[model samples]
Target: MSAIGGPCDRALWYGFRWASPKRFDAATLKRFADGHQTEAVAIARLKACDQLEVYDLSPDTGRQFGFEDHHGHFRGHMDGVILGLLQAPKTWHVLEIKAVSDAKFRELEKAVEKVGEKLALREWSETYYAQAVLYMDYADLDRHYCVVCTPGCRRWMAVRTERDKPEAGRLRGRAQTIIASDSPPPRISEAPDYYQCRWCDHAPVCHQGEQALSHCRTCLHSTPVEGGEWHCARWARKISVEEQREGCPAHLYIPGLVPGEQVDAGPDWVEYRLPDGSVWRDGGAAYTIGDTIEAEAYRHAA
Candidate 1:
């Protein structure tokens, strides 16, 4: 399969709500690796104690649980499952670990005190709640033990969450929607300057009409070969699934890959006519598909 299993909060959240092509910069990648290391350290400390029976799923061959649908296009993986805890009854529970900054931890602490851990988590981040629910459902567990720790602070909190079947079903349906459909879900907002959109890595591509599909697997320049191999038309080279997911700057959306009517085209740029009759320009340096640019500017540029 071209798509790898998504079990983390970020992947699941993006898959279900916004399946934009992810572009992880070096800083983001380093942050992820550091967070994983922090989690490993915390888990190791927990494993050394007698209060809990922790299972490590960080190893490549470790025991993990996952589910696939839509011909393995939609999938999820759990970090690990635990059976013992000092405060809880002896029953299986999903063990989820997260390392947050001290500032975030303080905010979480206040939220936990105000509304309780379960509700606080949902308020703090919907992605975390959705990930927990998916893990519970796929791992056949009814409870979740989410461990949150701060770097350099030995203190940590274990928050318990129960399975929410209704939410899980909704998320599952969303995942299926992404896998079965050609286009990604609508952008969170039409305005390029939207706060969320600004922070998102996919902002450049998601807002641009340069490519019909931002991902390599769906790009026009790429063709899937046997044995899950992909050949790039532009480079005439083989591409791996990992490389496809982390798209390059050279990504060009195939024409008609996006669900829209083409209204204009140039030697390097293509414009899709929007519902409001404004042209969405693709393949330009300053103008992108979803970005709000002046009509006169688009006309002059086109």
Candidate 2:
């Protein structure tokens, strides 16, 4: 219900609808609740910081700064009530909180595109960084903070650049002008493989017959690297279906810990649910719950 700036949620919601209407069943509400819980956790964390102000920039600004990409511009709306806005001397900071899953992150990443265009697909976090960079440009702020809180873990980071950086400032201006225009821009006859019709919400009408998953075929670096692994690229692949499922890895079942206890279960590869609602298969470790399941150990315990 709350609107956050990132396109991760909208991309996931649309993916759910496309994958199967059932994706928005009971689990959806739980996800929403979990999101709020994450926000609360993030707020608490922000309070711990020495200098941070969690306030509403929407009302005072009088204009919503959307993510210039396809989903942010046309399909998605930003979420969360700006956790906090930092101001000092003449500098400003925008704090955006996210309670999103790894898969949603992927969709949001792939959804980035030119201003006022149809949605596409990309990695979620990268897209988030792009959007945040855009926000920095919009607010004319120097640095931005992202506080991401999952069910059992909380992570916060301050992304700063010595300067505005060329693309960051220019993209924001172009997007703002495009958004304020009265008429919408024309559509592309065909999108890139990654931004094809299958995953696109407009796909139903566009009927481009493009498959939703695996847009790498059209990518310039499509060559396969056998036994090739890159440490940096691994982060993007971390959110795959096999790594984020309900009873998958990563999420360890801590016995006796209450739902609100702040416990770090360490890092493990968990199963992830894909955009098409299909659970990724992982032949890795598994986690099980015992009779000691409690609600007090998680970051938020009600």
Candidate 3:
């Protein structure tokens, strides 16, 4: 659900397929840590508010309020459930906390003041707004409240969004469709310099980087099945997470993911002619592919 709201369909597909391992640097790691601490501070402050009751954890299960679909393959977790806001004391609002830069905070305030919370929220960040709606639908709530703060917790603002069942339903269908797809979806941009693609993690393979981590999720034989399970047709069994990470000798890459054009194929192998005039083969085959350094390196490492 967190990724469902992203701009690129292909990026989301790549993520679901485990096309790339997510790697974050030290600065990014620190920022994530700081964000969590800020959320905690903000939650504590919210708890101090006399006008609202914050259920940070689900009273029903004594855990975070979480919901899922497609047999738990698609899931979402809320920041909390908010009750007793003075604006609508009887209504329950799904709570979402966000930490943004000070500049962004000011811009958000202006947008909210100009067009109101719901519209401002949709414009502020489609990702967050999309997530909020799904959260509302799963939680069986109609309203969502957002508490926005700065990194240092020096400034605060709130925005509220109403549930759109039709929109949420569409998003849910989108998620299910992507989850069931045997191949990746279309790219959002063709250019490497496109703003959304610039910092994307999948850029390497998506744009020409040859190496993709070998895993069941990236293999041709694996398919996402009903009941939140992954099945490997090659082995004729359910694939555990460990098995997915450590693919077998019979593993084959999804042809589309490779940079070359498919020139020959058979039950055992699919061959390609890479741009450098070298042949590459994914599985055991009689035809020889010359100089598959990348493939050799990956398979060797795997």
Best by TM-score: 3
lDDT head-to-head 1 vs 2, winner:
1
The residue-by-residue lDDT of candidate 1 on 1-302, one tens digit each, is 11222323233334432345556899878877878888888778778877667776645565555565555556566667776676665888888788887887887788889888667766666777888887787777898888888863366887888888998888777666654443444666788788876776555556654332356665556654554366666556777777677544445555535546887776446778765667667656654433534523323331
* CA lDDT, candidate 3, residue 149: 91
| Per-residue C-alpha lDDT of model 2 across residues 198-265, encoded as one tens digit per residue | 45453442234232332221111122222321111212232222222211212322111111223233
| Better candidate by lDDT, 2 or 3 | 3
TM-score per prediction, in order, is 0.67, 0.39, 0.90
For candidate 1, the 10 contiguous residues with the lowest summed lDDT are 1-10
Candidate closest to the true structure, highest lDDT: 3
Give the C-alpha miss distance for residue 201 in model 2, angstroms: 1.6
Indicate whether candidate 1 or candidate 3 has the larger lDDT. 3
Per-model C-alpha RMSD: 9.6, 21.5, 4.6
Which runs in model 3 stand beyond 4 Å of their true positions? 285-302
The C-alpha stretches of model 1 lying farther than 4 A from their native spots are 1-27, 58-61, 208-216, 220-260, 263-302
Model 3 residue pairs with clashes: none
